[model samples]
Target: MNGTDTRSELEDYLRRVRVALADLPADELAEVMEDVEPNVLEAFEETGSIEELTKRLGTPEAYAEELRTAGGYPPAPSAPTRTVGDRFSARYVVWVTGFSIVVGFFTGTVGGGRYASDRYVVLMLCAPILALALWLLFSGRVRRVDIESLREYQAARRTGRSAVAQLPPNVVEYLRSMQPAWWLVRVVLLGVAFIAALSVSSEAFLLIGLLIAGLVWAGFRVRQDRRVLPVVLVANAFAVGMAVALLSAVISDADSSRSPYVTADYRGSGLWFDGEPLDNIYAVDAQGRQISKFYLYDGTGRPLVSRGDSCEPSGSDLTNEYPKPEVDYTQGGCTTSTNMPVLPLPPTAPVSVSPSTSVSPSTSVPSSAPETAPGSTPPAPTTTG
Candidate 1:
């Protein structure tokens, strides 16, 4: 009975110690717990009574306080209170506006077709922020304090221990040697992801966020222990994966639009394929007359033609005053018969005649002798075989 009571008392004391140090970082809390637990358990084993243990070791609260002092941790706030609801202010307003702008730009560039459900994009972006704000507003304030010292202490301890015991000396030296270069790489990656997220589109946020989160996770882990190479690998993998995804998206769009829009060029313009004897080539000379015999050329300026099977004529687009013929060559083949509509030409200037070298005629010539002098005998025609 006495032993059971002592065990319960010891357990309760340990619980109290943990509760008191709850506000400390996870690593610090764990370290304190590890050191205190075994010592207390051993004391209990020998003493066989809670009263005797406390007489020598003091109360659990005092022990926890001593641990904090030794560990260089500040005391937690006694009356820390939670603040209900975060306010909607300039920062959030800016975030929301930026998000909207990104979405608007994306829609405009990608094909701003009206949809019955276009409102969904706005909802998706705003709802999360709104929910977070509401949560902060409704939730009561809680005690919070700067945890930098605890984190630093924990990191230092972890680094020392890991260097000596977990990793080989050569490996530790190698990691230390590479630290400066790694810092540069990290900064570059973070900058790229951040800039891309802002400039490209809101859809990039998810990818960028993932990359940033990975970077943060890896950074924290590396601070804790240099043996955390797995975290670093995973973070860099995310960056590479995101880059590949962006490239793939671009390539897919290019492949899909190859025939419809522009073709890839040596300069990598990726504009419409002007390389052809296509039917719809339109150009104007200095004289303001349309060039009718314009021809398509290869890179070397040689003519080329499509010998593919006959393709079915696609429907015509009559949006302009003059209609254009649209063709789908996916089925049969390519053709120069794609009669794209001609755009209206600009007005031409009247041909101005310089002063005549000879005296100007009073009236215009009839172009032929007047009707045989009003009934004179008609001239005979001469024929030759």
Candidate 2:
């Protein structure tokens, strides 16, 4: 038998011994102490002296053990009890750790290199809302049915297992099924699951949050209450920030016009040859590329309008406005519109300048003049002055 379970014979003998030696109390007590003390000192097996023996007896606990052994008694039993608060705190720690991991992973993934990615915004904005909804649904109404509310439940008494199970399904499951084997599997699954869900949504945190909310909702119905509001709330918060970033990106992305907001012509001003058009004049080659070719009434075939460097737009010297339809009188050029005047010279009329005279002729002529223009009569010719 264990020493703690004292035999009835030993107890009876000790009591009879005590009663039989009743005459001299001090001597009796001394005799009992002497007999038992040596036995205690011998148990350790190396007692040099009383001082050594007393030193070996560390404290009251050791002394009590010695007393219990000498008295032939069983050791007093300990209380087998745990408080509710300690259990609740342990569960809270696990839940918070798991939830933070999920939230942080999604926030980074969905934000991508830039949260401007449209899909990321969608996911980040919505995830939180989904979490809150799941909490409300699973927690069962705004007011929780705490044990305090129950008629039979009392702070004075221990609460029943059924009452604890009445907590959110997630809480119940954690308390009930949180075995080491299951926890190992869950931590791995959840770690990967958080990543997979975030990745699967293409880092679209809002969408992933929405998807998680659905999962949370369904889980609550199926009694998976550990799927709490906090995780879902984390996911949803990511969704919201992403959405705001996206909106800001869109708003801030002002589309500046690539084409000049206000366009003016090239002014087409430059030097020309015999076949070249005058400054600011329009001339099309067979392919319709504007050629500077134009016929000038002057002896030298310079561009007719705005011929020299002195040539400038008739109006605003700044030249900021749309090119005004100037007659191009300085050099003589046509406007872009077809309805504008045609300045073609006939071949028959030749420009004659007196080589002796410095002045050149003013007008041009057609090379072959007899052909009729569509609706016009031929102009009368003037004799030289």
Candidate 3:
């Protein structure tokens, strides 16, 4: 038969099954009816008693009656397995798998993939526990189901048509080869992730791709092997995503990137990381020529700011973005970057513990030398100013 005719034939088969199964729950209907999906093309190829096939597959009342007689209504039929969340079951295995994926993403993103090709190792570790969870919540999504559930699942599958709509048989078969499709996807994502990482010089993209591939591979392996490759992958992905977000959570001195806080000035010597301006800071001209920039920091773990180096970092006449020590302020009203003596002027010299540490020091008084002062003061109507 031609394409339209073939599809028509398939739909007719499914409609017969659906009517037979109309009284069943969607889960059950989907369940007993799924069999036809795997084998409808084969049926269409033959000329035989579809009636006999339908009879043996039975009706919704018959399937429900069979299920009720087997066990009390199949107990929600275990609602197909998902990649995460409801599947977690508080298992540490899942937790660790999640942990490792994060670790791998991080390592991978930081150009660490070359360090070890052990993504599979991390995933392998996570799979068993996931498999256990799958077994506990066993349904159509898992491996090692009993003969009855398996048989019923198979039967339903055989009864359903390959395509509910007008997809070609070869196309349908190609799509049905889910494992190959998964592997292809995994490879592509990872490859793209790698290239992007190299070009953009950001580990974050690769890490993300690592995660996507890991999850895909994990799910495939877990379901196919009746094992856990995919589960670990999913967990790993989550962990890495978390790590990336946390990587930049250096608590800043303020809510905004505004100043009196930290602002980058194209001028001045670049800010120091260990007493030297960060080498990564760059400078560019109007024509975009590189000269200098500074790596400014908030003095804790926040980002290493890259303020471009300027021959004279240009800004407003009013308040310079990188102010020249508007009296050396620090967060929380600390005058010096660290606690130190601020001696008053003719020169208000800030005696500092660190160039970076800005803390306002407490007052200090010089001790009077015993009673020498007593005699001196009585004598010192002459001076003591």
Candidate 4:
């Protein structure tokens, strides 16, 4: 036979032997396979034919049975017959566990702020389902082997490993190096989510605290036990969800707080004084004379028009005209007045001014005129002729 045929026959023999020993504990079976494989390879290489190898070593199953007997191991236990309910229960546990974990983590992370109660309700509801799943796992009704044996699970595992294997070695190592940092990053994300929720509701403190603790524990456990990897992955997903939720909430708040008049379609018309809207303007000249009508203009000479208060029949319109008509809602009915509601005071009394006695340019006061006494009126100035 060709070398390829011989190698294939050898591999087939080893595969059958492994199947025969499958009931052994994993470590013990591995030890038995290690001892048996080299001897089989040596015998095959020497014999040069499968028929001769089988005559010397017996069939693969008989060989495995001889090894079990020589090792003082008991006979393999018979496979248990699983009922339909058993299959259903295992599948139910798997599905419920996954669903509860994902939904619970999402609700717990996003339930902060105004919807704190919603988080509690969802968690409470999921708790029983999750507890049942855990019980099934611990009770061995749904074994790890059962889950791993599933076609979907095996396919996913193969796909993941294949994808990772396709990466360059250096890139894979770089990603491995980042794994430790991700644990801390997820914790920080949880903290950010907590603070964001706390800004709107104080009730998120306990929920976020528990999540942070779980993340820390999961990180630690995963380092020691690779079986905890699924837990770590779920925690990472939760952190990503938290970050997305926080970003969306922040954007929503910003949009809400923005002024409605800040949009492209906004056209501001009313006048404002010290942040307060002005419905109308009143103008008066320095002499307190009421200026009946006047237009306003800005520094650039743009008409500073505003919608003035309009009486019922007169619709509101933009105008720069000042002293708009006043509308009064009295007990009788609405009344409109174009006249100034507040009358300007009559012009102040004019100061009387007697004309100063004419002083001729030729006339001059004597420089040596005597100073006047305190209370006495100065004697009529004597003519200094």
Off by more than 4 A, model 4: 1-86, 151-177, 194-205, 223-234, 250-270, 273-275, 278-385
The model with the greater TM-score, 2 or 3, is 3
State the weakest 10-residue window (summed lDDT) of model 4.
357-366
lDDT of every predicted structure (CA atoms)? 0.46, 0.39, 0.41, 0.62
lDDT of 3 by residue, 1-385 (tens): 4554555555666555454333345445555555545554455455344455446545433544554556454433334333544333433333443455555455434332333334434434444555565454334332222221344434634555334335666676576668566556545545544554455534344444645655666665453232345344554454443334334433342345565334333323244433344323233333333323322233342333223323233621322123222223335542322111232232123223332422111111112111122212222122222
| Better-scoring candidate (TM-score), 1 or 2 | 1
Off by over 4 Å in 1: 1-19, 23-186, 193-276, 280-305, 308-385
> Each candidate's TM vs. the true structure?
0.26, 0.22, 0.25, 0.47
At residue 209, candidate 2 shows an lDDT of: 48
Count: clashes, candidate 1 = 19
**Candidate 1 lDDT, 1-385, residue by residue in tens:** 5433454578788867776776676556656677788989898778877788787678887877788887789986686433322222323433443454344334323221223134325434543664443233223121112121234434754575555556565676687789777666655655565565565555555534544564576576554332233334444544444345456667888888784443222212111222222223344443335545444333343233222213444423212111123445556665434333454443243333333211111121222111223333323323322
Tell me the lDDT of model 4 at 26.
51
Top TM-score prediction, candidate number: 4
lDDT of 4 by residue, 1-385 (tens): 5443466589789867876776666546656777788989999889878899999999998998898898898886677455676567667766665665677567645654465655645645654675576566545565444555566666866687668767776787787789868667778887876676666544455555656776687677553333334445545656776766777888988897685545321225555443454555675554556678987665345665655556656556767677767777874677655566676654344433323312111111322212233344323424322
